[model samples]
Target: MGVLDQLRKEADQKKLSEQETVDQQALRAKLYKTQVLPKMQQIFKYLQELAEHLNYLEVPVQVENYSDRFPRLGTLMQKDYKINTDGYGGFSDFNKLVQINLTFYCIGKGELEYNVQTKSAIEQENAFLHAKRVASKMYRLGGAGREESAKFVVTKKIPVRVRFEVDYEQSQIKVMVNNHTDFSTYTEVWQPADIDDAFLDTLARYLLRKDSEFVSLDITDEDRNELRKKLQSIKHKEEQERLRGVTEQKNSGLEKKEKLGDKMKSFITGKINR
Candidate 1:
């Protein structure tokens, strides 16, 4: 091939690569706007509702939204609860911490990801442990220990980190909780329509139970069932109100048509009389 022809070929390939990058970014941005943003908002609402539902349980919950930070990414963070047990073993007190972060990103094929990190530590009266425990016992049971049961310890006060990734294009959800001690992963493939408020609420419950080892958040199963019923009732009421508003609009339109007809009839009568 001639030098000029080679140069031309290289330029064309470079242009094509740049265009591909632009196309990928544009597609990701569109997915972020339509799918990711709505899901993130729904997740925030779910967490807020869950927090309110668990209020009677006196669970210390904090939910925050960072949706305005687009281009960079948006996040909904929930710090579920914190508790420290009475001092034991001379000077060490067991502690539990649960934090779940749902973050949105417009990247690659487009995705929404959530990372949940739990820190269960043994704090000496006035100091933190140097080698903080990576609470792996949460997943040690339920056949998860087949990975490394020896390395996974079950006592309270150890820290753990688990990540959940949602792939919008693939319609899949993946979970992984790995540390220096143990490594475990789970995948749940779902229909596109299944990713909604109800599903997210269920996920919230699952993550909390998994990380906290179902520690009584001072809430019983009955209490959780009641919360579900309350949420359903609120949704039904909202649907009723929406239908009522639509009916009112239809009635208003009918009234306007009647008034216009009456005006026309009066004009015709006057014209015929004249």
Candidate 2:
């Protein structure tokens, strides 16, 4: 091909690419305005209402805008808030404080995802220990000490989530709730038609209910048995050590008493001899 012809073709292709890029940007902006922005606003309002509800319940809560944590794409954003129950004397009367996190993700195509998680002030292992301690007190520990005494704590958190998506092409709103901590599996708790006033009210009420009734991690039979066994073994070892310490103290006391008696006898004998 001629040099001029090749150059012309390259220029045409570059122009076409630029046009396509501009078109894609325009489409994304349109989607964000029509689909994403409304949902985002709705979520913000819902969060405000939720915060008010939590305040009414006397729970300390703070909402934060975390959209800057992601790229400023305008099509996606996130907001996070935390409910601090530390002042409430922690979970189940434990000294440790528990913070509940609520994260809202606004995605393109009219999709809003909400995640509710339990945040522990302690390490994951200690969280499991606390759970085990609660389980022990609640009598939820089954067959741990009777069979295997090695597995004492099974710690995990299953966060709850609610997802709302608008299928513009399909002309329907898809709503799903996964109230289980195990993200791998989802249980459909509620299905709403549209993000209308009624739906928003219902969603707010549902979230409030969840806030009051915290998510509980599911402990399988195997885990329960193992935890019980480990707790039993620990208790048994502690008891043994305590008994050993007491026995040693008693023996030491006896030895000291015998030595005193011997000394008294020697003194009396010397007196008699004298």
Candidate 3:
């Protein structure tokens, strides 16, 4: 080939490569907007509702993130391309993926904390109760360990799954401890400034007649213990009634035997007199 022709071909190829890159970005953005954005919007609603229950005022949905629409799959030739293209210059089925993560900030009064308390047992109990409450809430919501399905036939409001990510921030406080020594002990208190806890715990119980996961989020220690106590009481009463029923049957049999003996004694007495 002539040198001039070779140069022209090389130039054409470069332009085509650059244009292909733009096309890919465009298409990725387009699908992201049309298909992905709607799901994201629903997820945001779920998060917002969660925050609202926690009484978080000014829980911003961060609308600015959605401003940049997903562009149409970037392209050069304006011909339609399928989702699966070879790595060199093709499409991918998993192309338009945008990850959304949740972050909670406490801009409220009286935050929560975790620490070595004076009553270790009480602290342990609190932790245990909280975990149970969370689970029971999930169950009532029809999310109890994947055993059963939960649904609302009327409204069809499904809560989005929010992945749990624990983030801790604390504010330190200094307390003076006086012992028998000349020098006083300095204790630094670390308290939680914010907590993204299950806010729907109480609400869940109010509505849940059963442990269905399709309900609300508020589950607490008192509620759980109350339930346990009730079940125990019911079981005990049922056992007592069952035992009482057996005793009654035995007594009735004994009384019937005694009556039969009396009848035979009276018949023998009459026969002798006759």
Candidate 4:
């Protein structure tokens, strides 16, 4: 090939590559502006409303915007926010508070990743132990040997996790419980536009309910039986106390009546003597 023809071809290729890069940049900017930013704002607003509901229920909750974590690109870096139940002032009844992390990958095709976490290592360990116990029980009931059960069924860690992904393509929220590979899965989808205050309130309550279940995973069958016995004992004591109170009232009333009769009799005797 001629030198001039080769030089021309190289120049054309360079120009085409630069144009493609520019086009890709423009597409990303448009996606962020139109879809990503709007969706992020909507979710933030929803979470803020949810926090209000939680506060009304006297649950310590805080919603934080974490833009400083990823600082770059136009108006916002990434839609990274966290809603955490603060365990302070002895307010949290549960041993562990739920921490929800919602992050939107805006640089890509706006996918929202939802993760639930807790800081209580003890609770996690207890849950793992309880899982093993339950697994062993099930294996025994199924006529499987204890050694086989221990080897096959018992996992090292029972990390209590609930994950959901906002699928924009299908307009559905794919929810995975405990582990992704588990058959226990469901979809909880809400249109971005349709998410209102009522929805947020329900979502907050649902999250709380799930969190409580996760925390209570440590309670085994033995613990439940013990609790049942204690409750029965308490009821029996209460019944005894009620009966005692009634007896005391009746005895006091009879004593007062007898004293009144004695006074009347003494007055009558004194009058007759006079």
Candidate 5:
């Protein structure tokens, strides 16, 4: 523990004289006053300084109510949507937040605003149709996503941020699409999902191709048999539930044994006392 404690312990075992104990204690007090305490104080202060530098804490993010009335004036350009490391953030997990810095304006006598929606949510409706075409093609390819001959879902959902602003009197509207994002060099590129030949080609051909520039294929048939097959494929991911059931059974057995042992111990103790 400490030099003084060690010496005192040694002295106790060796049966030192009272005068010697007093003398050593006095010497220790002097050393503490002159050397040890000051050094310990310095070390404590250094440690406190180091702790302040090492400390890292999460910044509490304020969630904006999308339906709330707009603040009189503020800039998204002035504020950064900080990324959270603990897996909770304003945006989705896979979102590559392309920073856009633009001033929200109220022109003449009107208020201004923009509506945001995820590209994934829009495509998820048609996911079954994509899967059906994929399965159909996979038969020709002879397999699925495996080492052997298989088909890959060659479709990816691309996110788009559509900005439409209306003035307070509702007389004016602005619809803007940037060749480059509104701010700092369009840096965030997030490929959220991978697609194989079937879905991609269908979506591209139906909505995003040069010939399909005016069309958007956003709806899907959920009652389709292809959708049911997709659901059936992922149906039994219950291994976790199975493991939990086993653990619960073991714990229950242990609890029953403990109760039985307690009852036996009490009965034995009663007999012994009698």
Candidate 6:
């Protein structure tokens, strides 16, 4: 080939390569903004909802800004809840309160950590009761490791940790529940599609009801069952409303088509008559 032709071919290839790189970068940025950002926002929204639900349930919970704690992780949110043996009495004994920390990582694959710790000695009875309460609440929100954490608290009271780590790329979630005692861990793997609010709520309510069987509290089985039924009824009503909306939209479209047909017919008749 001539020297000029060779040079031209090289220039063309170089330009194409540069354009491809730019296209790839643009695609990556679009994916991050649309898919990754929305997933992070959804996780953050649910976390906020969980915190609100706890507060509504009269649990002493505090939400804190933890963006600075994990500077490398981009955006992070944390919430701390203090659960005392005595309900709402502001922790009469330092040892009687269990501190639960929840952290959410909002970049790359999202990670949620639920760590519970007690400063006082682990009383098996109190520890068991506390673990059940904490686990039940966490499980309701798509957390796993309840049995193992309960066992850990029952045997040795130091700290129980349950973590839900999600990989958006792989669409998978890994759950680990662990305790300081024996370093025992329970692991569960799930697909992101399998985790939903309804599933989590149902599981959580079931756990709470099971726990109530052992611990005597003001909330009874009847009360829980009633609440479950009420929630189901609400869901049914929502579905009905959604169906009604779709039907109305279909009817509106049909009405518009009929009006257009009548106008067309009138126009044709007018033209013929003229």
**lDDT, residue 198, candidate 6:** 59
Tens-place lDDT per residue, model 1, 32-103, is 556554554454456546555554465442222322212222222233332111212121211211122332
State the lDDT at 187 in candidate 6. Answer: 52
* Per-residue lDDT of candidate 4, residues 1-274 (tens digit): 8999999999999999999989877875665445444554454457656546554665532222312322221231222223432312122212221222321121222222222233254345346447523221112212333221111233222122333334533333333343211212323333344445654555445454433322223345576466556555655765786777844535878779656755655543333221
How do all models score by TM-score? Answer: 0.36, 0.34, 0.25, 0.32, 0.16, 0.30
lDDT of 5 at 74: 31
User: What is candidate 4's TM-score against the reference?
Assistant: 0.32
lDDT at position 190, candidate 2: 20
Model 2 spans with C-alpha error above 4 angstroms: 58-194, 205-274
RMSD in angstroms, all models?
Answer: 23.2, 34.5, 34.1, 33.2, 30.4, 22.1
- Over the full model, what C-alpha lDDT does candidate 6 score relative to the true structure? 0.41
Residue pairs of candidate 6 with colliding backbone atoms = none
lDDT tens digits, residues 97-166, model 3? 2222332221112212222223454445446435322111211223435433322111111111112111
Q: How far in Å is the alpha carbon of 20 misplaced in model 3?
A: 1.2
Error of 6 at 18 (Å): 1.7
Clashes of each: 5, 9, 31, 0, 11, 0
Backbone clashes (count) for model 6: 0
lDDT of 5 by residue, 100-162 (tens): 112111111222322222334324423633532212112122235533332222221111222
Error of 5 at 186 (Å): 50
Local accuracy by lDDT, each model: 0.40, 0.41, 0.33, 0.40, 0.31, 0.41
CA shift of 103, model 6, Å = 2.9
For candidate 3, the per-residue lDDT at 271 reads 31
**Rank list by TM-score:** 1, 2, 4, 6, 3, 5
**Native-to-model Cα distance after best TM-score fit, residue 26 in candidate 2, in Å:** 2.2
